[model samples]
Target chain A: MVALATQTISSMSNTDIEIVVDDPTAPEENSPAVASTRVVDIVVSLLLLALAVTLGWDNWRTGASWDSTGPQPGYFPFYLSVILGGASLYGLGAAFVSRREATETFVTRAQLRRVLAVFVPTLLFCLATQYLGLYVASFLLIAGFMRLVGKIALWKSVLTAFVFTAVMFVTFDIVFDVIMPKGPLEAALGR
Target chain B: MEAFGLLLHGFAVLLTGKTLLLMMVGLVLGIFVGVLPGLGGPNGVAILLPLTFTMDPTSAIVMLSCIYWGALFGGAITSILFNIPGEAWSVATTFDGYPMAQQGRAAEALTAAFTSSFIGSLVAVLLITFLAPMISTFALKFGPPEFFAVYLLTFCSFVGLGREAKHKTVISMSLGLLLAGVGMDTVSGQLRMTFGSAELLRGINFLVAVIGLFGISEILLTMEERLALRGHAAGISLRVVLSVWKDLPKYWVTLLRSSVIGCWLGITPGGAIAASFMGYNLAKRFSKDQESFGKGRIEGVFAPETAAHASGTSALLPMLALGIPGSGTAAILLGGLMVWGLNPGPLLFVEHKDFVWGLIASMYLGNVVGLVLVLTTVPIFASILRVPFAAVAPMIVVSCAIGAYAIQNAMFDIWLMLGFGVVGYVFKKIGIPLAPFTLALVLGNRAEDAFRLSMIGSGGDMKVFWSNGLVGTITTLAILLLFWPVIDKALTSVTRMVRPAKA
Candidate 1:
């Protein structure tokens, strides 16, 4: 169960390098909790604080003082980073002291599962588009989501996906002539 | 009267076959997007913006603004029938709209909602028609300090009036400013935060972030609840609309009050969501039958829809006159304005009178078109909601991906869009406001330019913002608004102490 939860979180996949956690209190399907609101709050605020510090350092290095022409490029961003850092600190402090939030679930396990179930597939669809092309990847994604998550009949999902992808291709590629990524299949078919 | 001549010229510009066809197409597409769960005005506008890249600026704006009016009308459909707000601003509509639907008055509720929206938009357009030119004329005199002060007030108002936590709003806004500063610095011609990536050189496109934040993140959020969109059946015949129109005059006070509230909020940064809730609450408070509110009252539907549409329409006024977007969708439209090689702000009125007046003219015609289209097609849109979310969600995702990729024909944008989507999901779940983030991102560089220019002019003096009376007043107002939450609490506590002593 812990491994499954970790896998789900890590499924963010090429989206970012945010920390992933294995919450022991991720709860059962019946219980409505994946992590406490306090924990998520602390994590997010800390992440923001880190971002603020990094940005502040970068802006400082880039020249944050006023020059002859005007304030330097980094002057504005440096002050903005300061505000961001201060706000993050305030958020962190508030989250730590807020007892009411400590009892609340950031997202229930069932809700997180539902969210991740769609998100992981979406990330994969984006990755797959690089190799398989937009239309093919989209067709597979829609069909797979419909069949697996929606629990629809196989033929219905396949048919729906095909029809949808065909309409999109016509609208974009044929009608509007908006250029999109085409793959080996389109290359083989010539133009 | 000069404004009248300009508006007539605008109508003449709009009286082309191609423009009318685009209007109808935009309305239909707008309604379709609005009826869906995850797609709203901002997302719809962002997704379709690229399609207008080659069109004339006047026609493009007309079509895009028509989509906005259509979305405003379409939001009422889901709120009335499905008890789900298709748009965030329409959430208040579900209070009485869904109740009326449950009482077998879905048609009546939807008709009232659409009619009120039409009335609201009409009033706002009238305000814009007469007021925008004058404001722009006044804004023509504004210097850099004044522009910076105005931008300061715009961002400050979000912190002051937004419902989110103060710190979260600050964090969201500053983060956007940071992101906006990532690419090449326009004045210095130096990279600020690109690190070393080649893709970062072009900067993060607002369109991609919009598609990801509003479009993709919305889909992910919708998936969290496993929606079953079993909704009330609605059949809006002409008779139902006529009856609703006849009954509408009885609640003229609610209509007028809501429209006023919407216009005020829309012109400020209070926004459509706040306007809707305030409109509903005030209507309920002022009504004799307040108890009937939230239980199937037609006035309940009227208040929120009217205010939402009105504010959503009027939010464009500031964007036109001052180059400051009053809402998220308006911000995207501002981005589109830049993409079309037309500068926003007061100069736009003088330079691109045709485009400006043409858009104003379309706001009038488009709302009428939207009202008629929605009244006849509510049933079709409501049924469209009956389609399974699983099927619809993926299609929306694909459209979003296409929108992102189409920005610069870059695959990197698609990946960046996915990243922003995850960020959006996390931010939303943690109650970080997205509106300020978007507005800040769109307006950040412009504001920085104004600030730096002011500093340059004033020899890096901090008092430059307060050097002149006009700039000083605006700067003071911005600071007051930024600290309004604290000041308000202090005043309230003081009032409480005084009242107790008097008692």
Candidate 2:
């Protein structure tokens, strides 16, 4: 069992080589790093490599060679996928070679927290838009962000959200008459 | 003279009250978007594009082009007063502009920047007026091989000229091409890479990608940085404008050189950001007082602003003439043209003469109106930046969401936008150039089709790209450009070796 685990680890390291080192210039920060640049680089390049392989395989499946009509549908994309794979390999190799960037912080603990603070809410807003509709979702998003993240007074946040939503409704629905996702509230207040 | 007569007829068509009103409205909206962080010319136009969907093509093009002009002018405001570049092209403007603002010369710097932009745009418009017809006529002779060669040249130029890593650029561009391939193949009637999703079958929309990449990614990036905006108060009066105009003639050579650089980059795909930096660098190299440039020299302000505006304006020429966009915003405009049921190649000149001329005429009129509006309303617009970024951030996000959904009126598009937003953020962080990615996405299928058509015609002969002088020259030039970095290095090394031996 121990021998098998050691062999598997060696194979994994050989396949996706990554070098982690300490940066001489990196500041001793309290926030700490969420991940090193080398790790992110390795992961991203590997993802790109996987994408290229999948695309290449799919294109090949769909007839990449030339036929009676000149070229097959997958001919161009297959070649493009080959180029992509080559580029991804170059990126992966560069990441492993470049020692200076290896130890660099991709993002700090605090920074990632802040990024997630916005990203999470935005994702929720998008999800909310599906059911609550655009206007209500927008109102909740604006008001909630301002109140929770921005730390504005409740009244002020509510007022700003209300006015903004009203203007959007007037502009998109009434003035321009562009169709948007409507919820029960909009349906209830029918023309 | 014939072009001039058509231009006058175009002016007549654009002089209507409704069109004029729309122009002003577009300009104001454009300035608002430009002054705000996380929003810019390309996505600004993208957001407003759906609004123009129902309008006449001429009026719609006029409004959109005016927004382009307005965004160009508005970028200088933030660069000069706030020391924060509102657009990528305006980053160089802050080198001297902010220092001038610190010395209480904000109004003068503003005037010079605005005036230089006007002159640059004026020159670009004139270039378009004369050159558009000639280029389109030339393009009329192009066949599939020639078209493929041109597209090859366009993509190769990005690799050759772009400052980003060559591997990264290749990756980004190839990724875009792959994304463009994610629908049913038009030629073979075979599904390419839909992954069994009905939504993917319709293909990824460039507009949605642009909004997410530019708009949503910008907000996320801004979130990473502390978003505090403090700007100098700009109060430009008639006297300030006049005084700046008097000093401007002293730097006429700088202005002229920058404009020329801008026009060249614009006509090519070097883009406005590259043009601005080149303009600034060239001006500094030629100036007698180079040391004073970063220390508050007005010439420093003049060089970049002029080049950026000139490049931005003239980028439309290729889009009009060759159906190839020279910049990102121009790509969006090209998309708008297609959405309007107007084919955008050489035939556009022959088929929609009125629409073509009217847009050109609007370019001239719009710049004049934009100059006056931006100069007089600088204070009001600058104050808009005073709004807390917290409030402004959410508003911009909401606008991006609305714009994404409005593209196809589908909820899936909104989700796709969010996905692209994350992708864009990561791409930007990793030093991959977004412009080539966008250009590839927009032009991918067309280039592929042209390639396949050429192959069909030549019975799969690889020499078809070099079969004719025109196609051969373009293909050879593209190959040369693709290896430009290597050639450039070799030439420098050879010169160094020879010089030492001679010594």
Candidate 3:
């Protein structure tokens, strides 16, 4: 299929013959909304428009006019907000109208699943940072990924995570003397 | 003759045991930071700036500056080895660098990159040593209008000349501008876009945003595969390194031209990332092997690395000669200077000739040291690529989280970074170019501030940008560049008509 498409593209310069061909279809995979560029564009545009309204309203409240003290704080920002809304609206319109990108998928289902596998863990790690502090949270996060995603041995993952977090403690906490967030473990250790 | 003498004295001061050891330490730290995603040159310097607070300002600054050098050199390592840009400027390096790694010429590519960077930084430092005093005298005449015009040119150049989805570029830039405007409206002392959230009060930090966008998004992208780091494994030897060296001089024109671009843009506020972009574009435009650029061309790696290093180093020239910082890292260094009782204006040249000359001398030695150090370490850094993707990806996330948290010690920033990462991933998935977004995020606030101040100075006259020849010419050129497609179309059509008539 790929080779045939390439051949057609190479022969495209010969304008005399008009070729009608459909792309070779594979079994359809379930698509996430993020996979569609059009869906993403519309969503992004609407959010930007909302941002414009919020900004424009705030600017008006703060007196978007030029007082005797020259332009108000919101004057320049207000105009920028307008441009943002305008550009985004145009984009939203274009997204719906564009023919070339009618069914183009941004990513396949498998790709999203892969991204989520890493992303969900990272997010949980961020939430865990508040409770466990940087060091403990990192240890768990690293160990989790190592054990779960990597399918490594429990001892190996624990050891690698321990060593990694231990090195970080020495570097940032001890050597650079940088003050990182500490949980109960650090507090008890008197670090 | 006098420069030669000053340079000798500078070297004399630079070779001290404490300074030499400190410079090595700086290079090591830089490599450590630069090879990691999220931790960047500016952030690395900012983090270490406090360590220098107790030491002698000169020695402290020498270490800090060497870290910057290390970080700049370090960026190319990861970009080539792991397809991650540790620094924003190294984005261009990944174009051909990863391909070279895939082709098993990783050693050759890395050698060219480091050597080209050395040449670029060496040329910039040399230019600074001789031309700084004179160039700064000319820079004193610049006003807000001129600054605004220059910024307009840069922003427009990205949006106009670069072949990307134009609307996407505009949308990305607008998002950046909007993000930058959040927090406080400093001009009027009014809060805009804060939505009354305390986190919004501090505004979004560009570095944190960068961490999320490049570092986190890259991890997500890597996951699509079963995830093992891959590299070209012909391996680094003295032979390959020497072969790259011998082949390097053939592209001296690219090296020289990119260095010049890096110097000019660095001295201006266009900065390292812009310089790299301009260098890569210009190299592509002029190269005989244009098609080979993103396909592992050695020259592609050289163009951006050299230009980025040159600009990253020479950005100091403006900070020393003028009070203005030409780059984010330079600004932090300037803040450090002020804390240590050294003003960074013209008076700095005379007030502390030893310090200035020593710093300059250290740039020379630092690049040499950095190149030698990083070249030796490339094998180790590259070998890390042999690790399974699952282990490495998680490690990248944790380090990125720590790096993000280390900036403000706020878990909120990490959350924000995660948001940016997802956005970055989606943006890439959709066809949005990130270079313009990052540039706008960095420079948008300054450009907007300059325009407003210029307007205030001119009593709301937009023509203030054209009031002086310097500003006017820049404004004209910016306008021309903004409409370059139309101008380009008209010119080409005219040529087409003339050729047919003549034929």
In model 2, the Cα lDDT at residue B479 comes to 93
Comparison by TM-score, 1 against 3, better one: 1
lDDT of 2 by residue, A31-85 (tens): 7888888788788899999999998999999999989889999899999999999
Q: Which of the two candidates, 1 or 2, achieves a greater DockQ against the reference?
A: 1
Query: Model 1: runs farther than 4 Å from truth?
Result: A1-29, B496-503
True contacts kept of each: 0.54, 0.46, 0.46
Ordered by DockQ, highest first, the candidates read 1, 3, 2
Candidate 2, after superposition: displacement of residue B379 in Å?
0.8
Interface Cα RMSD, each model:
12.0, 16.5, 12.5
Chain B TM-score of predicted candidate 2 relative to the true chain B: 0.98
Note the B-chain TM-score for every model. 0.98, 0.98, 0.73
> If you assessed candidate 2 against the hidden native complex, which CAPRI class would it receive?
incorrect
Where does candidate 3 clash, by residue pair?
A35-A106
lDDT of 3 by residue, B1-503 (tens): 67778888999999989999999999988887687544578657755665665578789889999999988888888788767777779999999998987786777888888999999999999988888766656765768898788778766766776666677777787778778778887777778878789998888877677777767887776555433233332335678788988888799889998999999888765679888988999999998778888999998999998899889888888677765567767766775786587866666777788998899999999999988887776655444333445566677777777766766668888899899899988787667767567667666677778888898899998889889889999899988977888899999999999998998
Off by over 4 Å in 3: A1-34, B1-19, B25-113, B128-133, B225-360, B494-503
lDDT of 2 by residue, B1-503 (tens): 99999999999999999999999999998988888877899978987887887789999999998888888888898898888899999999999999998888888889989999999999999999999999999999999999999999999999998898899999999999998888999898899877788999889988899888988888888666645545555568799899998887899999999999999999889999999999999999998888999988899999999999899999999899988999999988988897788888889989999999999999989999999999888877776665555677778778888888887889999999899898888888878889888988988889999999999999999999999999999999999999999999999999999999999
Model 2, which residues run further than 4 Å from truth? A1-30, B497-503
lDDT per residue (tens digit) for residues B419-500 in model 1: 9998898888888999999999999999999999989988989899999899999999999999998999999999999998
TM-score of chain A of each: 0.82, 0.82, 0.79
Evaluate residue B84 in candidate 3 and report its C-alpha lDDT on the 0 to 100 scale: 71
Q: Backbone collision count in every prediction?
A: 0, 0, 1
